[model samples]
Each structure stands twice: as C-alpha cells, then as structure tokens.
Target: MTITENAPAGAATGADGVEHVDVLVIGAGVSGIDAGHHLRERFPDKTFAILEKMPGRGGTWWTHRFPGARSDSDLFTYGYAHKPWRGPSIATSEEITNYLDEVIEEDDLKAAIRYRHEVTAASWSSSDHRWTLDVLRGDTGETVRMTCDFLWMCQGYYNHQDPYRPEWPGMEDFRGVIVHPQTWPEDLDWEGKRVVVIGSGATAATVVPAMAEKAAHVTMLQRTPTFVAAVPKTHELAVQLRALDIPEDWTHEILRRAYIEQFNELTRMCLETPEEARQFLLGEMRPYLPEGYDVEKDFNPGYRPWQQRIAVVPDGDIFTAIKEGRASVVTDTIDTFTETGIRTSSGQELEADIVVSATGFNLSALGDIPFTVDDEPVDVSQAVTWRGIMISGIPNMAYVFGYFRHSWTLRADLVSDLVCRLLAHMEAKGATTVTPTLRPEDADMEIRPWSDPENFNSGYVMRSQHKMFKQGDRAPWTHMHEYAEERHTLPAADLDDGSLQYR
Candidate 1:
C-alpha cells in the first residue's frame, strides 16, 4: 500500500502526471475507494486513479460538514467491508469522514487520489475504447482532459449544489436565514432561536433533536407523517455477549448483521404487505408519543414502511426529545414562508426565527455526467440496471450506488467485488473490455418492487430510472438488503464469465 500525497490545501489541482491508467474512478467516496481497491486487487498490474472534486477526499463526509449531520444507520454497515468502522454505534459525520480517511491511509490509497481534480465531463472514444475526462483542479486552476481505458463513476448523486427550495409564497419576504441541511453555513448562530425544520426525512429527524439540544425550540414540520424506527446497539443478549471475550470488531459485525437482517425483512414486508407493514410500524411508534396523539395522523406515512424511508431515531432518542417537549412534530404542509415564520396549508402560521429545508436531494446520476461509448453518445437513460452493477451496451463502465432501504456501503461493497470478478473474467478471457448486456427478460422497468420508494426522491432514481443498469429483480440479485447474502454475491464470487466479447 503506497499513498502518494501531492495534494496541497486547495479545491483543484492542475496538470502534473499524465500517465495512462487502466481505470479512472471519479469521486473519492466509499464507492470510489471500493472501485480503486477492487480494481487494484483484481488486476494487480492495472493502474487506476481516484479523481476527487473536493480539496480533500470524503465526498459527502467532507462536503456536508453540517452541525448535526450523522449516519442514520449503524456505523457497522456504513464503511468498507474490508475495514470495519471503529466508532460509536451511530457514527457522527466527523467519525465517518475520519474513517474514510483512515481507509485511505490504511490502504495507502492517497498516492493514486488526485484530490481537487474535479471532472467536468467524460467522453469515450469508440475506436480506442478509452474515456477522455475533462477535469479542473481547485488549487492550481488547471484543466486537463486525461484519457483512460475505463470509467468507474463513484460520484454518488449529491454534488456541491444548493438544495431545491420551492417558492413558498412569502419566502422571499423572510428576513431570517434559510438553510438547507445539505450545504450548511457553518458560521450561522442559532443559539437560542426558534428553529423550524422542514420535511420529515432522516435529515430533519437528525437536525431537530440535535438542534433542540441547543436551540430555544425546534419544530419539525412535516406534510405527511414519516415512519420512525428505533434500534439500539446493544440489546440484552448483545450486552451480555459483549462483556465476554468478544472482540469489538466481531461485536460490530454481529450487530450490523442483526440490524441489517431486521431492516431487510422490514423493507420487504413494507413492500409486499403495506397495510400490515403500516400497522406494525405504528405499533412501534405509538409508545413514543404522548396521550391522545393519533399514531395514524402524526406518525403513519401515506406510503408503506420502505415505500418511503423509515426514519432511524437511534434508540428513539428523537422521540424522547419530543416526549420531553424539547422537540415537536407539526404535521402540515408549508403554504409559504412568512417574515416571522412558516404558514401551513391549514391556514395556521407558526412563528419561527429560522427555517431549514430538509426536503430530500435531487437524483444526482453519477455526478451528473454524460457518458459516451466509442466516441458516439450512448444514452444511459435508455439502459436497464444489470443487477445494479454494470450498464448494458456500455463496455467497461461500473457505477457504485447504494440502497435507500439498507446500508449504502453494502451494495457498494457488492459492486466492488463484482467489478473485481468482471476484471478477472476479462483478464482470463484476454478481453480488453467487458459490457454486461441486459437479458431480454429485463427490458422493462418495474423497479423490481423491492427497492425503497424513498429512492424516488434520491437523485439516481429520479433522473435515471430509464437507464438499463437499474435493477429489475430486487434483493439477492439486483438488490442486497442483507450483509450475509451480499457477501455471497460480492467478494466471494468467481470472476469467470461467458458474457463478454473478447478482443
């Protein structure tokens, strides 16, 4: 493991090393690291580079240095499968970011990381089967169009764009500072002000409780109720088990497995039997609210549990905050923003000193890049997800994306191992490039019916559902809701294949 640290403190880098690499992995997030690590493992002689846009690595971790940002899922399943997360049960944004840094350090991946080299666009040449990337370095203000054999897009949907703020009727009239949880403004002071959080997703859930800890009053505004699920890191059995000679690594693995197993089944149940799922979810939520609070009205979502993402409360801590009157959930759609507060559709205007939009992210398809095949434009929008790994008709391009239902890294890890297998298959067959085309059966788009409907709000699902790479079959094939099953599909599989057209 050799890490070459040439990146000085800046946003971009200029022309320096123009050496040819076999693969160019864009975005140095969990996906990018997997791409590089897997590529290096499968094709030991092949060279790859991770071009990160930020001055440093850690995509969302670095970009979103928000005050109360943390993982909604357990940290055990959040990081690289090879490297476990050595932090508290629920990892803070700082912890996850630091873990990613540690991954880079442990694997010596920094040498190949071209930090601040933001890729603007990628063009693939058909005759040469190579991708030419136009990248801008933040520090040097230098732009270079580098060439590579294959393009591995690890840039998760979210980019450095401002969140979408709807035109609330009197929003422009509000004198207070309006903020989106995505692009947080660090210097803003909300010490003792009344803060109203918009939307009912995990972001809002995360912000409200943490803000209530400091703010005078934190109001969580929701158009529809969001299903809240609370799971503790240590149950009675796990607590007793941890006291023995059980290693922290093994303990985390077991906890990650157990939680993923439960969430996976819960997601499937929500999709298959929505009403039953709703009833089950409400059963869990009812105990958190006070007397006379309608579970169906305040906590029951219009959709099934996984239909929209079930908000993780981390031991029902957020509900406790609300239970203690530190936080309140107002179930109403925002009619508009007033100078002093937000007015709901029910004609009630609440006073607020600050308004935060936790309204989800736009479908950011692989860093919003236009992919080309053999110099001709290959429409990715037209492709179907080949088990959510490789795109049809496009040769040697892999995209790393995660499930909204399960941990993001679980799927990424699968794709990483699959990439390794595909590389080995290509090497054994003496093929320069491999494209996994969709079988005739997967030509239509039904979304496999298992993927969390919240993905509809995700940037990838919004923009690229029409793509051939979108999974047709849900879990075990296209979707992996469990860690144990994913291990069977990923790092454990053989790379030999008959799907390639050899050179």
Candidate 2:
C-alpha cells in the first residue's frame, strides 16, 4: 500500500459550498492545534483543515477573560510536548492566549485555520468511508459543507456558549449587579463594592482572591468546601535546571517528567490511602490559615482529595486574603437572595453589592454537534469509548480527552501520537477507514461507567456523565485516568488487538 492523495469521484458539492480534505480537525483549541501539528509532521501528504468557532485562535483562553482567570494546572504539564512553556507555572488567560498565538506563528498553522466555522452537524457514510460536516459560518448565516476521510473532534468537552447557573429564589429582587464569571461584563466596576461569589470550585477560588484585591470585601459563599493547594508561581525545577547550563528544551522536558511522575504518585496515594491523604492535605492547609480558624469546617471537602479537581492557588493568595480579613468564606446553603444580599439556610444574612456566580460549566460532549452514522443518529451515551480517543463503532474518527488526575496535555500528547501511528498503519494497509470493532464475547461483558462509580464523583462529571460515552470493564475499552498506566500501555497498545477493524 503506497500513500497518495485520493479524492472519491462521488464527492459532490452541497447547497452552500463543499470542500474535501483527508482530515477535518474541529475547534482551534490546544488539542486542535496539537492535532494539526501532528498531522503536518507525521503525514505531510495528507490534506487537513482546522475549523474554529471563535473569531480567532485560543479556544478556552480566548473566551475566558474574567478577573484572575488562570489555569488550575501547571504550565509545564499543560503546555504541548513540542512547545516548552517559558512563562510562570500557572498562566493567566492573556498569557495563555499569547502563548497560543506564538505557537500558531511559530508553526505557521494560521493558513489552515478556518476561523468562525462552527460545526453544527456531522454524518458518517460507511459506503463512502467519509464524514460530511455541516458548518455554520459566522460571517454569513449560510451553512457550508465539508467532507473529510477522517473526522477529528478536537473541541474540548464543555459548552463554552453557556455556563451552569442555578435559579435562586428572589434573585430578581436583588438590586445589585449579578455577574457570572463565564460572561463577565468588561466595563463593570468592582472597586470598593461588597462582593459575594457563589460556589467553592476553581472559579470561585480564583475570583475571591482577585476580587479581594480591588473590592471593599469579598465573601465566598459555598454549599461545600473544595480542596485547594498552593503551587509556586514559578517552576523551581526549571529554574534550577536552567542554572545548571541545561538547554531550554531539555530543561522543560526534565521538569515536565518530574511533574508528571509526581502527580501520578499523588493520584496513587489518593486512591490507596484516602484517610491519610485527606489528613495530609488538611495539614497542608493549616499553616495557611489564621489562628483559631476552623480547618475541618472551612477547608475539608466531603470527598477525598482526588475525587474532584484540586484547585491550585498561586502563592496562597486566597488564604492570604482570608488571613488579612480582605476575603471570607461562608459554607452554607442559600435560602434565598435578598434585596441587597443572600440569606443562608443557617439564618445568616450576608450583605453584598455585587454577586459573582462562579458556578461551574455546563458540560458538553462533541460540542453538541448532532452526529449520524449511516443515516442513523448516533447516541454517544449508548456507545463505549475505546482508549479515551475513539468511540467503539465510530469509524475513522478520534477525539481528545485529557486525564482527570493529571495534566490534560499529557494524555493529549499520547492520544495525538497514537492517532499518527494509527494513520500510518492505515496507510500501510491501503485502507480508507478503521473502526473499533467489538468482539462477540466482549459484547456480553458487563458495561461499566466511564469511571469508577465510587471514585469519580466530581460535580461536573456527575452532571454530564449521561451525555458521555461509557467504558467497559477491560483494557482498550476502559479509559485510564492514571498517567503512569497510560504512559506504559498506550504506546505499546496493539492496533490488531482483535478490537480494531480496517478496510
């Protein structure tokens, strides 16, 4: 089988216009950019294009520009394997966007990006061995059609257009400003205002400290406490490596590996020793709080450490704000919204002039793009995911999903590498398509949740679990959240493991 460009003669134009490519990458996020880079480097002969819904590059970083918006994960792990992060460990939205722009310029991927092309629907044709995508062009309301041999869903799993906001009783009665962090008003004045931030997650953790700096007093109102840790703003290992006359790329690689291994160990500890891990984490929080403060009531979460994402604060900013009396935390249920503030279930009335709902995201899968396989609408909830990349019966398609336990890009790099390898395998076989074909014996196997029912109880995961594909009880069918397990198993995974069928 020799690799060469092949366009089917049956390919025809749709009502608006039609374009064909070897690979169609959806969204211009970090995952999409990595897919583009991998395709260019590994399969130069194959034609591909990236479709981004936003007006420009940087999907999450571009859209989320709220006050104190930064990554919960460190930069070394979040940054791509090909690109070394030169900024601080935890990067702000602007810094991240700038890094993405630099990556686009450095790799010269701007030409292949079709900005404002939002994919609304995708249909797979088994007979044609291609995917037809209906894309909505932002400039014009017209829907354009794009056909590709392989469909890569690089859009990160979450609905960026809408965030989750619970309806509160008497919320309308409040006379002050109410803002959700997702769509923060750019010109809104926050200075010297009594601010109340709802929720106790990453968004709330960042917003409380950030608003505390400018506002008269900021109060974080939470139903439950979330585990928060302090990570250094700068990479100490990178600095030490650089001081040792190590090359920039080498230094980055060393620090990246170190962080990955460390996180992997941490995840293991959380799973194997929940009691000890919980106690240790709470102990870490003790020093950051003021004297006589209640650690168990204020810092301890209902769940174990790694059950949900651990929010990282740079230099203990949030703790520092609380210690200095600039910010405060209230752990109680909201009874109702008063005219000037919120009333708690404990009969506590907190006065606030501004309300910031730092509530979590409305999780989404495949960007709500309606999918059809051979004219039959595909239901993702009914299907099983294969290796966290491809759905069991989805032919010639892959999506990027990151690890819940560690850095997102760690799994992303592995997925991209596997995809490039699989593409090469298909080219070697002279095949146009490959799908994860389930065996007859495997069909009767008991289906399990995408994650362990007991271990995976994150609020977002629980809310969106029904929309996501399931996982089987065995290998290749189960998605591994552990980086150490994936690092060893994924590279060595056999394409001919009786699961993948090629044509």
Candidate 3:
C-alpha cells in the first residue's frame, strides 16, 4: 500500500537531545503502549520511546472507524493486562478509545510517544549489541534512523492491510457505495439506504444491526455461518469492579485471572469431546434464536467452536433486530456485484444502495516491518515458534502473541510479565541481551490453522502468530484447547526449558 495522508511525519532532524534508550518500542496501539508502560515500571531511568505511525494513538481503534465499530470481546477482557476496564461487559469503540486515552494520560506517556514516526525497517547489530531502525515520519516525509539495545514488537496484527474486498466478479463496477467496516468514513450517509453486510464473522454481525437502526433495509450476506453467543454488557461483577477502589494495576490482575479461568474451562469442554462441546454451546445459545430456526445453517459450525473465535453480542440484539424485521440474513457466497446489486453463487441477487465489505483483515506480522534475514524476505510461515512467544531465528526480539481459545488480554499480560521477568533476570546477571531459541524437537510439530482456514485472511485469526504447543505435565497440564493450558504455559517465573543465551 502506498503512503497516504493518514501517515505521521517526523518532527525535526537533529537528535541533539535524542540520545539513546535501553529499548525502542514501536507503535502506540494497545500492545505497544501496554508494553511500554510495563517496560517503564520494570526499568525506570532506562529511557525508551514508543514510535507510532499515526498522528494519534489507538492502533486498530484509531484506524478502523467503521459503522457500529466496537470490541467483540467483553470490555472486561478486551483491555490492558495492567489496567482493567471499569464499566460494562462489552464496550463501544468510543468508550474503549477513551479508556486507552486515560491510560496514556495517567501514565504521563505523552512525552515518551514519538507520534507520526513509523519504523520502516530494523536489523540486529552484532557489533553494537543493539538494533538499528530506519523510520519514516509520514507527516514530515522525513526519514530518521534510531537504535536501541532491545527491540520489542507490540504492534498488533490489525495494522497490516486495508479491509479486504474480494474481486467478486463485477464488484469493481458495482454501482452502490462499497465500504469496509475497518476503515469506515464518519461522513458516510447510510440513512435510509438499502444496506448489505458481507461475511458472517464478527464484523458482519456487528455492522448489520447497527446500520439497520437508520438504513431503510438491511441484509446480512454470509459465506459460511458462524456460531453466535450472547452475554450482557453489564453485570454485578462489573459494578463490584468499579466500586472496589483498588489500584488500576491490581484490578487488572484480578480481572485478568478471572477471565483466564472462565475462557479456559470452555476450551477444555470443547477439546474433551467435540460433540460435548458443540452440545454445550448449542444448549446455551439455541433458545435465543427465533422459533424453529435451524441451528445447522444459523449456528452449527463445521469447524470446532473456538477454532474460530465465536462472535459475541449483547443479549442477541442482532437476532432481535432480525426478528423485528429491521434486518435479515442471506447465506450464500457472493459471485459478483451487478449493476443493481450483488449476485450470489446461489443464483440470487440482493439489491443494495450501500455494501459493506466486512471481509476481514490480512495476516501481516511485525506491524509494517518487512524483514530480510539474508537479503530475502523472512517467511514467518516457515519459521518455528519457541513456545509461541519468540520465533526461532530472530535474536534480541520477542513477538507479541495474543490469546486464542481464551481471552486475548490474558496471554498478552503473560507475555508482558515474562518480558519483564526476563529483563529483570538479565539486569541481575549484568547481561546486555537475551534471546530464547526453540529446541530441535520443540520445533518439529506440524503447524495447524489457529482459526478456520476459510477465515485465513480475517484479522482476528490471520494477523496473529499461528502455532500451538503442549504445556507442563499430565492430563490437564497439556494445553490442547483451553485458557487453563495457556495459564499453565505462560508464567511470570521460569517454566519452560528455554535456551536463554546472553550476549
């Protein structure tokens, strides 16, 4: 993608007061910002800076302004590991963004942020025992280089590509207004327009009902159906959390443990027997659907539950919208866009005044850092993971890995803790660097799709590091498909047989 106006520019040329830092963090999105805070707390007086590509903070939140944009995960689980979200179960985009802004404000992270600067490339320097980075500030269009002893990749997955628009035959020539939920335009006029939301994942599920509030007609178009689960956005526990008067970091830890346990049990039930899992999920969700609704077409998934992150909404409001006839569903693959509307593979064409391509995000790792191990683009697919935290060949780096089959913030918190723990160990040992390597046997397992293969391009599944590992000893110890497994696998203390080499 060519550079656009949204990109930030470097401030000034001279590094007069720039000096050097113990770490150079990239991107101020959730992962980057959260990691930067942890780094600061763990090692104060060690100067570090967060280099963001945008004019402001909020990585995916800032970039994706789609209609009805909100978090799929409950706010209780979606936020930072160190700072808990105080209100509601699921939060709106605006609310979440506000939460992040507050985190930045309270921490006094503004001074450490170098906004508008995107790291174009970074390489490990053997001689200097640090990493050299080349940055381009979109605002100024100036190139600046930076160096840091340790480079951390916290830029989350959603940064890579624009929302995908399949070249469904004649989509390019469709006469309707086509938009992606990821990059929604605020000025867009969807009022009273006939709208069709494409894809069956969370994005499609989210946009249809939200737009139905104003659009004259709303129709959801799905390639394959996904399992739907509904829970309330407000609960007693949330009220208790807000009233606790506990410190933010302590609150973060308590809620973090609670969610880790909740999601882990569900994962275990699913992996114990796929049938029992499906039955349990169906039992919990089937009653909410309209009378006589077919679970097979509407919710029965061919892939295992949690195989694709299940879509969650508040109290099945989407179904309520459909039941009230404000919205409807169409299960068919899109063939092409016609002059009037979309022609699906089922020989049906749905007319629409505006079409939303909620097709999902692409898998681009390391934010925008295009790496070359030896003058060749490093193929992340071909690389092996060292317990899903660090890649085998990369040195002086630790990739941020989110949760699957569990809460995302749960694993991220663990990764942040481990990074701090490791750094403290290095500090005690008087070491300059530490890199974890995967053992020969540990790297031999066959890789499986972390999410559904059909969802290979969707951001939630694709944009993340995709590899699974066994953890600890005995039956429950193996992390086949539960949050407990991850809880066991990722510990603040040394747990794994890691190859911790120092330079």
Candidate 1 stretches with Cα past 4 Å from truth are: 1-17, 40-42, 233-239, 438-499
Candidate 3 residue-wise lDDT, 1-503, digit = tens:
22222222222222342235567777787777788778767777666778888888888778867777777776666787557677677788788889989988877787778888888887775566777678897878988777677777878766445545577788768888988876776789989899998888888888888899999989999878787777776755556755877765666567656665676677666656768888777877767667777767767777877667788877787887887888888888888888888988989979999998888876556775766543456555555455556654566677675764455665667777877777777778788866655445544455444333432233444445352222322221222233465555567335334555676
User: Which scores greater on TM-score, model 1 or model 2?
Assistant: 2
Residue clash pairs of candidate 2: none
- The lDDT leader among the candidates is 2
Each model's C-alpha lDDT?
0.72, 0.86, 0.70
Position 105, candidate 1: lDDT:
78
lDDT tens digits, residue span 1-503, model 2: 22222322223344445678788899898899989889878877777888999997877877787789999888888998899888788889888888888888886677788889999999999998999999999989889788899999889976888888889999999999999888888998989999999999989999999999999999999999988888788878877877788887887788888888778777888999988988988888889999889989978988878888888899889999999999999999999999999999999999999999988888788888899999999898899988899998889999999877687888888999999999999999999989997887697777887667587787778888788889998878888558888888889889988899999
Residue-wise lDDT of candidate 1 within 144-175, one digit each (tens)?
77777777889886746746555678888997
lDDT of 3: 0.70
Ranked by TM-score from best down, the candidates are 2, 1, 3
Better of 1 and 3 by TM-score: 1
Predicted structure 2: lDDT:
0.86
